[model samples]
Target: SLALGPSGAWSRCAPAAATRRRSDSDAVGRQAGMFPETMSVFGNRWAAALLVAAFLETTRFTDFQTQLGAPPSLLAERLQTFCAIGVLSSSPAERSGSERSTYLLTDKGRALFPVLVAALQWAQQWFRAPEGPAIALTHRGCGAGFTGELACDRCTELLAGAQISVVAR
Candidate 1:
C-alpha cells in the first residue's frame, strides 16, 4: 500500500494496481446506470465540482474548491479521481507564476456535459426551484430557448419517458 503522507488514511493511498481495478469497475458501473457506486470515489461534492469546473474557461484545483465550496484536500482528492477516470485532463500551467495545475475537459468529459444538462433539466421540471437555472441554453439557428425534450426522429413527436425501454443484460 502506498502511503499518503502521515495521515494514515487507508483509502487515501490505495495500491496502484488496486486503483486501476477500481477505475475499471467504476467505468462499468457508470455504463450500467449504477453511478452511485462509481461516484463513491469522488462523491456528490466532487461531481458537483466537476460540473462547475466545466462552466469555467480554466479549471484549477483552487477554482474547483471555490466553486464547489469544498475543502482543499477534498477538492484535490476529487480532481485526482476525475483525472484517473479519463474525464478530465490535467497539465502543469505553461506560464510562470502559476503554482497550481490547470484542468481541461477531455472529449469524453464534453460528451458527459449533455447528460448533466439533461439531468438538471429533469430536476428543474420535477423539483422545486428556489432560483432559476444559472445559464440558459439557446439554439443558434433559431435564437430560441432549447427545450430539453427528446423527440422521436421518425415521428417528430415528443417521446414519452415510458416509451423508451432498456434491455439490461
Candidate 2:
C-alpha cells in the first residue's frame, strides 16, 4: 500500500521485504499488473482526446479526425486498437447508405466516464486556467455545474486520499 504524505507525494506504507532482490522475473511480474497496461492505453498524446470524443458521441471517422486534428494513420490505428480491446464497436454508417463506418463506445468504454471526469477535475485543480476552465460541465439531472466526487460504492460515503489504500495481492 501507499500513503499520500503532507507534501502530496505517495510513499509505500508497507514494509519492504529485507531479503528480496531485483530480478528479471520481478520486472515481468510488474508488467503483468493492470496499472501499467491501463497507462499504456492513455499514454499517447491523442488517446484521451479520442476517447473523450467518442464519449461525446462523435462517431464518424472524418469527424474524429477533424475534431482532433490527428494524423489519419494514427487515428485509424487508435480506433482499431479500441475495437480490438472491446472498448468500441464499429458499424456501417446509417446515412444514405454511405460506405463509411461509425464507432460507438461499448459498456467497457462507458465504464471510463467517471475516470475521465476525475481526470478533468484533477486538471482543473493542478493546471492553470487563466481564462477559466477549457470545458465547463453541467449535470443534466441537477441542472448545476458538475464537480466530480469520489465516494464509496458500498457505504455511499465520500472518500479522500488518506481513506484510500492500494493493496497488492
Candidate 3:
C-alpha cells in the first residue's frame, strides 16, 4: 500500500499479510534457517549467470569469464564455490602441459537443468522483457515445447504452492 506522508511524498507500506506468519509451526522460520546453506550454493550474486552459462556449454575458465563479462576474481570465487560443493568437476585443459583447467558440470550441476528452465519460464511469464527472452528450450527427443510445470508423478497433474503439504518425514 502507498500512503501520503505529511510532506506529500508517497511512502510504501507493507501489507499486513507480509508481517504475519502463515502458521504457528514456524514453517517459514524453519525454511529461513536452511536458506544460508542453500544460498551458499545457489544465492551468490552471479550464481544464476554463471550456472546458466555453464548449462549452455561454457567450459573453460576464460570462456566463462568472457561470456559472463564478470571479473576474473569473482568468477574464480564462484567456480571455487561450485568445486567445493561437488557441483562441477575441473580438469587441466592441457593434460600434460597447459596451465589452464576446464570445468565440467557434474551430475549434481546437470540436475539444475530443469531449475534453469523453470526460472526462465517464470521470468518470461511474470516479467516483461523489452527484447523478449534470450533463448528458448525445446525437448530434443520429440521437439515439444516446455511448459515448466512441476507435475506430480502420482496424478500427473501440475502442482502449485497451495497444492503442497509438508510433513516432518
Candidate 4:
C-alpha cells in the first residue's frame, strides 16, 4: 500500500524519465531561439497592425492607413520595409483605377501573431483597464473565457515572474 499526500490519493504512479528528458531538450531548443532579431520592425503599433491586418485579410494601402489612422506616406514606408524583410508581399491591385497596393502576410508574418498575443496578455496583467479588455478569447468548444495567462506548458500552472529567465548571446 502507498501513502497518499495531502493533495489526493492515486493508484500506481510511474515517473517517466525518458519523456521528461525529451521535453526538456525541446524546451531548451525553443529558448535558444526565443528572442527575435528584427525587433525594430514590430516596435510601433502601425507596424504591428500591418502584420495583424494582413493576417486578418488582404488589405490595400489606403484601407490600412484609414483603419490605423496613420499617414499614407508612413504606411507606405512601413509596407515597403516589411516587403523588403519578406514579412509581407506588396503589389498593385488588379483594378485599373485602383491607386492602392495590396499587402499580404508571408508565412513569417503569420508566425508573429502568437508573440503579439503574449505581449497583449502581459499588458493586460500589468496595465489598468480603462473600460475592459481590448479583446477577449472564448473557447469554441466549452464556451469558457480564456484569458491569455502565461503558464507552464508541462504543469499547466501559471508561471511566476522569477521562474522566467532569458538569455541572449
Per-candidate TM equals 0.65, 0.76, 0.74, 0.60
* Lowest lDDT block of 10, candidate 1: 1-10
> Could you give candidate 4's per-residue lDDT for residues 1-169 as a string of tens digits?
1112232111111111211111121222233332432643554445555554565474787667555555666666667767766678877889998776778877877777677667656755676355555445455678876655668889888987899888955
Model 1 stretches with alpha carbons more than 4 Å out: 1-43, 140-143, 152-157
Model number with the top TM-score: 2
State the displacement of the C-alpha of residue 134, model 4, in Å, after optimal TM-score superposition.
1.6
Cα error, residue 116 of model 3, in Å, equals 1.8
TM-score for model 4?
A: 0.60
Q: For candidate 2, report its TM-score.
A: 0.76
Clash pairs (backbone) in predicted model 1: none
The per-prediction CA RMSD against the true structure, in angstroms, equals 11.4, 12.1, 12.8, 18.0
Q: Please rank every candidate by lDDT, starting with the best.
A: 2, 3, 4, 1
* TM-score, prediction 3: 0.74
- Candidate achieving higher lDDT, 1 or 2: 2
Report the C-alpha lDDT of model 2 over 113-165, residue by residue, as the tens digit: 88877886687578634555545567777777767789999998999999999
Lowest lDDT block of 10, candidate 3: 9-18
Q: What's the CA error at residue 3 for candidate 3, in Å?
A: 44
Better of 2 and 3 by lDDT: 2
Q: What is the Cα-based lDDT of residue 114 in candidate 2?
A: 84
* Tens-place lDDT digits, model 3, residues 80-114: 77776667889888668888989998998888777
